[model samples]
Target: MNPEIYSLFDEPHADNEYTYRHNIGVGIIATYLGMKLGLSKENLSALTLAAMLHDVGKTRISDNIVEKPGKLNEAEYEDMKRHAIYGYELLKNIPGIPPSIALTALQHHEREDGQGYPQGKSGKDINLHAKIVAIADVFHAMSSSSGYAVL
Candidate 1:
């Protein structure tokens, strides 16, 4: 993991605190897991960066929707699901970022069982880095301390 890339969110922004903490946790966990899985240095770096910014699109979401204390209404849930594609669109054209990183952001919510959002990719169709980020994201979101906890 590149220190500078990770350091980008080191100074918390008051409004983005939830996003900052959640993405940081996902990044740390994904980096450790990537190392454990023997990913190459370059792959691990991409994974770390992708994990850190996987939810960058959430910044575009209305705070009322993102910070809702209870369940999102049906329409809000559908709107929220667009974050993956929004993140992908935000990242795809950026110079220097690996294509895998952008793909990871696009596909992180895709499930192995074909029950996910945006593209509904499943099984081998999903990128490896995206799968890793998805697991890490869920782990962080489900942790008791995370404000995004659903269960």
Candidate 2:
């Protein structure tokens, strides 16, 4: 993780609008995707914000595991999966951010088949922002050469 990303998790007072700093491609793709989906400008902003900060909970994870070069052990994987909930916990109380934004962080890992972590909310239970973020996150990860790419 970048030192700045670490500060994002460690420093609560730091800026939360980290899309421009962390994943500009994801932001652009998410916005474009949202526009394609016919989302309004206000909805687009919410979608962009949710996509950018979706992984902010990674700060709660251990650096040793986060920076590990090899694939993680089962325990490490499980621990890392808690980032979704950590992100929700981190953002839920912030005064300015929307509740949907926090839900986006919480449910981005959730799947339609109830296979996702933290919660198994399937189908309609999942929020739209989370579903959009999931798609954008996957698109960015696969297209980029970063270590996060799994497919």
Candidate 3:
């Protein structure tokens, strides 16, 4: 891995271990799924990177919101959702970060049914990498033992 990329995964975060592990797990699973779906090598690499950093915006969230143990109230839930936009802003201008990678952060929360957040973009409007990450993110959260309040 390039040092620049390594530094991204290595960046210190005040969040708990579960969030880190979830990112790793989602990266692996999303890459595997993408490969099975016949994504090219370049796309697979992008998918892995994007999926791993899908929740990178969470680092910018308040500890109280990010680490909240139980269900969040309406206001907090709305606040928690901003992590997607925050993640996009954080990665969009990085020298080596591709547009797709930055976009994955912004669109991963969007859904096929057009009921997603931030932009509420539907189906084709959301990037493919983001869609894959969304699936992987949810899968990792649901499969893990940790109590993820939301994805």
Output the number of the TM-score-best candidate: 3
Better of 1 and 3 by TM-score: 3
- Candidate 3 segments whose C-alpha is farther than 4 A from its true place: 1-3, 11-15
Tens-digit per-residue lDDT, 124-145, candidate 2: 9999888887888787777656
Alpha-carbon shift of residue 149 in model 1 (angstroms): 4.0
What would the TM-scores of all predictions be?
0.87, 0.82, 0.92
Clashing pairs in 1: none
Estimate, for each residue in 39-91, the C-alpha lDDT of model 3 and write its tens digit.
99988998999988888888788888877788889998888899999989978
What range of 10 consecutive residues in model 3 has the weakest lDDT sum? 6-15
lDDT score at residue 37, model 2, on the 0-100 scale: 96
lDDT of each: 0.78, 0.72, 0.83
Q: Pick the candidate with the highest lDDT.
A: 3
What RMSD value applies to candidate 3?
A: 1.7
Q: Would you list the rank order by lDDT, best first?
A: 3, 1, 2
- lDDT of model number 2: 0.72
RMSD of 1: 3.1
